[model samples]
Target: MKKIQFILSFLLVGLLIACNSDGKNNSASSAAEIVVADKVLQNGTIETMNPDQPTAEAVAMKDGKIVFVGSNNNVKDFVGDNTEVIDLGGKYVTPGFIDAHTHVIASSFTTSGVNVQAAQSIDEMLAIIKEYSDKNPDLKVVQAVSYRPAALGRNPSAADLDKLGLDKPVVALGNSSHDGVFNTVALKLAKIDNNVKDNVPGVVYWERDASGNITGAAIETQWMQTYVDIGAWIPEIMVPETMNYMQGYLASQGVTSVLVPGVITPNFGISSEATRQDFEDIMKILTTRIESGEAKMRINTMPFMKLLDADPDDYVPFAVRMREKYNNDMLRVNSLKMHADGHYNDRAMSMSEPYNKDEGDDLPYLAPLAMSADVIHATIMKATSENINVVLHADGTRVIQTATNSIIASKKAYPEATTRHRMDHISFINPETAAQIMEYNIPLNATPIFTNAVENGKDGEAVLKKYSKETVERTMGLYMEMAQNGANVSLGGDPPGSVVEEAYPVWLFQQAMTLEQPGRPELGAFPQNRKPYTIDDALKSMTVNAAWQLQMEDKIGSIEVGKYADFAVFNKSLRDIKPENLVEEAKCVGTMLYGEYTHNDGM
Candidate 1:
């Protein structure tokens, strides 16, 4: 009887053990059933750019969206057996850079053309062009870009390019891209001659010699026609190749998204339908590349207002069609880009004061306003009425004032329109105008790169002459002032316009932090009012604020759960680096878009 009782007790103990094991198995299975992250990045300082959370030690992404952002230990629950874990090894992560305003397509074309951006002299430029021509014997025409007449000490003429002895047509575009020096062959190819009249006085026409003979130099709207003609002659495959290179370059610079202003500038003599179709063809190429995964950056493009006669009412249907066709996670078109004034460097910016003088011209030059206040107001009212955003290219203070006033009037007229209009290249703004910008909550998409270039002697004299010394000393970028005043100011490289060797966000950040020209410690653009921005401020300008300008705050520009996993990893902590050395020391280790690495230096 005792042996039987002991056996029974042993059996009971075995049954309890089995039940506990079954419970453990069930719990493990339940935990496994929870959604797992596709990728987990940890052991790094992550600047989320999310004011609510601010920072994190790890981030988990699932299906191309952030699922977890917190401490490293907290991310473990989101990690699965198949998750591709990346140990950052104490590197720093920040939201991917967003270029608020850029000419991506134009920049790509420049990249593919005879790149004379580095030529320091006319002789060097000619030699470079000769070399490019020699390499491509089959080329029917040569288009060189980023050629600075100031760098050459004078503008090159058709006679000068003829000295190169290239049988093919050749055109060298100025850094601004609004001006160009065409050789005799190019002039013939574009069909510009003595009889070619200037429809837009001072804005578009050929530069003639004293005898009124065309000198093969053209400016403003004329260059647009030349660009189209030259593009038509170039090989078709080059366009996609150049675009591919630009995408890779932008990825290296940590740019995950871009706003391409003015995709379709008016071809002065071309039919409206032809212009629209041309624009569509270019977009199709870009879309094909994006669909093929060759281009990873998100692009928001705006059609040129001039293409639709600068009448927003005329463009609403086109904008709607574009949005219907291309509005997606990767690309969008929902805005109209108009030029209120030309480039500041060209002394074409409409300002309150007249420019000092040109070398040969006797009278002080007052820059011409591209669009009248009334016209701008009408355009804005019409565009807003259609619920379409408008981005204006206004560089000078007067232009900014006009644009702001028009926008205000339009907002009042179209009370129901929820348009987030932006002013691009607000190079000059007085305190009063700044206040107006803040009051309206208008986004200023500025080109800080241009300021840096001016400070560095690229066009310092022109800027100095355009504005009084007192004005120069008081306000340059007014980055801090604008921000303090509740203005939404963002940065854009505006590349090829600014002539940076490479559009590096770190370099731009350095420029903002230093406010001093490279190699010119004595020459700050706004010496007395030079306010160096913090690294955080610069980052926000390139990321969060820029995203806000594009109305993409919900999707990207921050490392937060439920947002796209688009962030860049730096080799070193940006916060720890000295302000001056940020450009030199800071290197992008990796750039991720949609949870995939678009560029990985370590790889």
Candidate 2:
């Protein structure tokens, strides 16, 4: 083929004379070759999260791949004086923010260190646990977390934990491991008495009312492990002061990647050899804080299907020994997660309609809890015959039709593995199960920041009181009707139970590019499931279809040339704002990866 089109036209005219070279290069003095780019964000507007030729302004990067992107008249031939010429005054770059579901080591223990999720009553959740136990009086136990108990429709007692003093131990947490609220000396340091009630071994219903006692309320994940077992008796310098309030809220939320479905176990017996050696010493202390730059994101973690044994074939040899001990790309282990039900504010979703009517004859189906749908389709056909990826948590539409018939019977019995399954909080689906979930190319991670379950549930006012007035303009997302029908979906931020109400989708991309929900004006019940979404289809359900569902689309998400240089910036122009000003007109300042600046912005 004309010598392969003359070696691709001499490598695109030697990459346009090395993008006009000033970017240093005695070409082969190796540090793994081609060291250029000390900087060059150039004129901005990049969005190279790529969808077949998406545009860019200037990208560059050298040692970490993306050798050059476009414009800046070929990146001003790598601007000398040791590079560094940002000028993104035009703002809006893309990629990075691959937080398709998060947790950053339990967001370094909830930022604002001890959140109590904006309490809203019950003496504002005890003035946020009496102002973090009166400003950490040598902390013995304040712990707190995403606690939402139906955003306070009730729960929190033992006289609201004897007015926060049974000589310490407060315990709030409920960003849905169902619910919690301890106090009576953190339920006698969680040795739940009345000589024990039902739920145990990873928590559930520590509930009680008229005289049965123990009403420091709780529902599941074993009564929020009596407030996470009072954090293994706290005081390890409050875990680096909760990891510097979780890397300043993931570098002011431009978050680069997290996954971490859930961890922190000494018990939950999900895995113990002391939690697989504290999951290989917390992935070697989050890969030595993402390698000495002090943790700036990129972690994948998994294990909590109550540590798999409801027999996911006896946890595929501890999911092949945590995919051969945390297989890297910046901290790893891709899947085994599990839940299948609970949370739409504890209607205990397993619904095939029956969250009421006397508990639809007493919890009639949220089944698949500890298995049975042919053992969760032979544990998703033994995690697609060992190519792994099985996540599964389903939120409504009869638990996403039991993970859409176990991903169409494990892609016809692993005819060729790679089911790379995932369902996570799929806030409702129907239309013959969204056409059998777009005929099995399965991937529906949704959580449009649970905008209070369609502005406060009852199936968000019955999907706008019976799809009225012209089937309320045809609706779309579930990842744009599974990518306009060819199916391939992604996105999730149900992290530490909905941080920024489900990790950064910028106010769920202004309610999915304006189906409207900012500060509700009266639940029009998903306006008959409002549709219309574009900003390049919600930035491909958050970048190159969430990095091809974490099979990591040729190195971290986008920006072409041999890949990697990650990305994210933004000061404006997310398609020139205003769908209720895209989350206060965008913010996530900077991020970059392989090529460094693990989290800047103030440039």
Candidate 3:
């Protein structure tokens, strides 16, 4: 258990505003000089990923793009006379949803903590840390963050430290980096007694009794971090007034593009270490919180290559000093992430075979969590020859065939960064090796369960430990049977990793067709591959194949003519709703993004 070395930290994010096409906020770091307007709204319904399949209604916008989508009297010569019209009372629109992968400061630093995600036991998560330690009794402790000891089948002892008998100190978070839950007076202010043993590497150690002790569980088995030199709830979100309640919780979940997998390294282990907030302290706290307007969504990020004592040619001068110092497309960096394996209940997922909960097939595998698989395939063939963007995180099936054979041997030993290499949390690969993913159609991103599906009242053979229930119904619709034998899927939710926001695509499209949950009706999500995805193939795996897996599908997934008006007005009709009121009729009351009005949703 000695391989937690994956230290590759570097941070710098400064300028980068760009979003014009009318959604405003364009610091014009690049791409601009576009102006074309005339008789717009010529037509609508244009989610055109065009392999032929169209007609949502008709779309057309002006100067800000999408001047015509077809037939509302075709773009009246780009609709001038200061063109501006409205007519979607015919509702139903698409083309604004592309969350390929997540974590983005673990779902935007969960709007700075203490939300025990609707607490479900541990006495409703110690009554949300006893009402935030009875409302700041001298602040000193209490940490909430992210929690889930397999959604409470247990883990959080020193007798769940008698609910802070006020020795003041409690910590929680384990929507898995493979478990965490301090309490023992924060394990004696992190002194962690009795042969402390945490040879670290993402983390894992439930191992109990016979005197080897340590049964308050714990996990990392590959990426288990838990530190607290104590910034200690940094006064419940170091307020400039907690950044407008985390930008009104991402404009009430319309979430106009965000990535932030994690960074601000140094003690990049989830908490403390010479405390560095890395990435140049997240570009001096997001370009000084976007000049005090406290910037709301659109921020992109992917820093975390930490392989312990660093230096493997520090990731192309740390992603060319974060894209020549905070490029654009909203604070860009292009990707590096890497983890290769961990989670799926920390049997450390590198499994090709053997976890029938370990017995017989000689019980082994687990531990590709970080390091030596030829040093994680020579750091994904050295960040695919430094064009950066590698991503990794493969949850089992021989770490998705050693991450699809180290990204087809790092794009055939570097044929110039072929530009796509993701793989993250790919829950259960191997349906006859998914016809080797058409070699590398360059985009294989998979999240649909919007990343975690957290109403997890637990069951899927009690949350995966070596799986069952016929291996979670034969790996639940492996993303709509590999996007109906086409692949290239993307869509994200991750938020607090599972609480697929108010209407999570209708309880995860009925748990991807009955993998089960939502008035139980007898459990299914994939009862023997139930496979049923059509709401136009789950709205083209969440809009034009998740905006062509972030190549940004010709300016934000189709609304078309010129594109980028970012939408979602839904009052109903995702083809006449009802997969039982399509989770209260697909909500989004209003959510424009590029056309502004960033989310009204009636809240």
Candidate 4:
């Protein structure tokens, strides 16, 4: 997380070379002239996101690498007869956005099924399921994704899905991908019932009614991953095609690179030969697309280490093998994703304080699956030793502090390591832990949209009712402190785990700035005492800090002379627009990757 200074001394060197070109009359000087660009963009408001030379009027590129970055007048020297010159006419541009933490496979898989994200209640969800089932009679299992649990009014049961009147099994996954409800037919097929014991008891298990009957809800990955296995049986759920569609979708959204916390192949905690083959097949297709110039977004994928119980020896070497196999600019494998704790809605998160509301269990607090701090430290050390970055899925105050300490210990033990370790979905943290994370230079990735109380329905009310306002005020506004301290902070959409529309980088930025839900400003921002983040802080989190988290800062984060020609073009500069109006006013008109237009909306 150390600041990476991009030296502009190259600009002076280029000026010297251009100075030699002044003697145009000499016959022998033609061959010795400075190299011309393959493409040039001029007359634009370019925000480079680099501390030095933050703005530029023009940029020149050759062979996909930036050749020159300066004024339009100076860029003329790089214009040749074959160079394609784009007159920006004062369009606003920034380094193409990077999603530091996401689940491409899970998001892509969602595209293959029915989406009930807009359903307002259980009845409406049933209606959507009925319509989809009627349309796809040939399909054996009807799988749906992005259903919001909050909109359902209450915990969903098989009886709710039974209202669809479908004989085939039906499955509807939650937007967070943490909870799922299956129809009775589906339950029978998966062999889940009241007799089935919980994987981790309270933290991960089937939802049951007072009569001890299975409500058909599976919480967390223990049984929720059964959806993936069921989806595999459906022919329409094609991995290769769905992945391509997702890549294009991301490019259209102006996302040039993504760091997938976990690839689709391996079901969580279940790494088998078949899953490995699935991974290899997907990687082959991705590498082929990149080689064929068809893939626009760069991907940095990581293998999901066994959640809550990752053995360093098992996961670290597997991560190294993956890194060895996919060694390319377009596709990379350099990180291992470890789930450190459960989510808040399930009352499964390991928190420092007890929840006011309980799930009838005698225990007041839930412990993370990675129970031992020693185990976390050991895993971090192993990953760091192998030069593999670790992305910990840490939520709740206690686990966040634990994860931070483990990372700090690893860094202390291996001072020379540069793995770019990070923790994502950092929902809660105290000032002391935040200071340690900043001092340790640990990159923090936050999905700000998740913090919006209005969007989270009554869960926000539950938070207020469960904890004291003083606790919320102290821990909830940790990001503002980190931004003020100039810590390496990055943002991600975390699709399948977020509302699809609210997960885009632009909306994410808006959330970061206001910490309020769109269209429902009446609720106001949560933790009202906290000041909102500035536009610059949000932009840096999306661009440069994101690149640093991916360890690709030198190559693509900023619009520098030596960086790749990657940019996101907007109709209006983000700085000129209101935070709430960003999604509408600051539309991404074009997306450029490596000097070519990946998505062009006539810009």
| Candidate achieving the largest TM-score | 4
lDDT tens digits, residue span 456-513, model 2: 4333443333222232223223444555555666566565565554456666666666
- Alpha-carbon local distance difference test for all models: 0.73, 0.62, 0.54, 0.75
Model 4 is weakest, by summed lDDT over 10 consecutive residues, at 22-31
Cα RMSD to native, each candidate? 7.6, 21.8, 24.5, 6.2
Total clashing pairs for each candidate: 0, 10, 53, 0
Model 1 bad stretches (over 4 Å): 1-34, 131-138, 227-235, 264-272, 358-364, 454-459, 465-467, 470-475, 498-501, 516-529
Give candidate 3's whole-model lDDT: 0.54
Q: Which pairs in model 1 have colliding backbones? A: none
Per residue, candidate 4 scores C-alpha lDDT tens digits across 56-153 of: 88888889988777778767878999999999999999999998876664345544478887787888888888888889899877877777655565
lDDT of 3 by residue, 180-208 (tens): 56666666666666676655533335444
Q: Can you give the lDDT of residue 201 in candidate 3?
A: 38
CA lDDT for candidate 4: 0.75
Prediction 2 global C-alpha lDDT = 0.62
The TM-scores of all predictions, comma-separated, are 0.86, 0.34, 0.33, 0.90
Q: Per-residue alpha-carbon lDDT of model 1 for 1-603, expressed as tens digits?
A: 999999998888665544322322211123233358899999999898877678778888889988777777656777778999999998999998898877666345444468786677888999999998888888777778877654565557899899888877787877756677888877787788899876455545677788889788776555657656755334265455545666567788788998888753334223445556666878898888787878778989867754324555556678778988988879889787777776555566777766666667787677767777777787788778877888998878788888899898878888888899889877677778888888888888766655654332443554575567666544556656686455787877776565434455887777777765444454444333556678877888988898888888999888876789999999988999987787778889899999899999972
Worst 10 residues of 1 by lDDT: 20-29
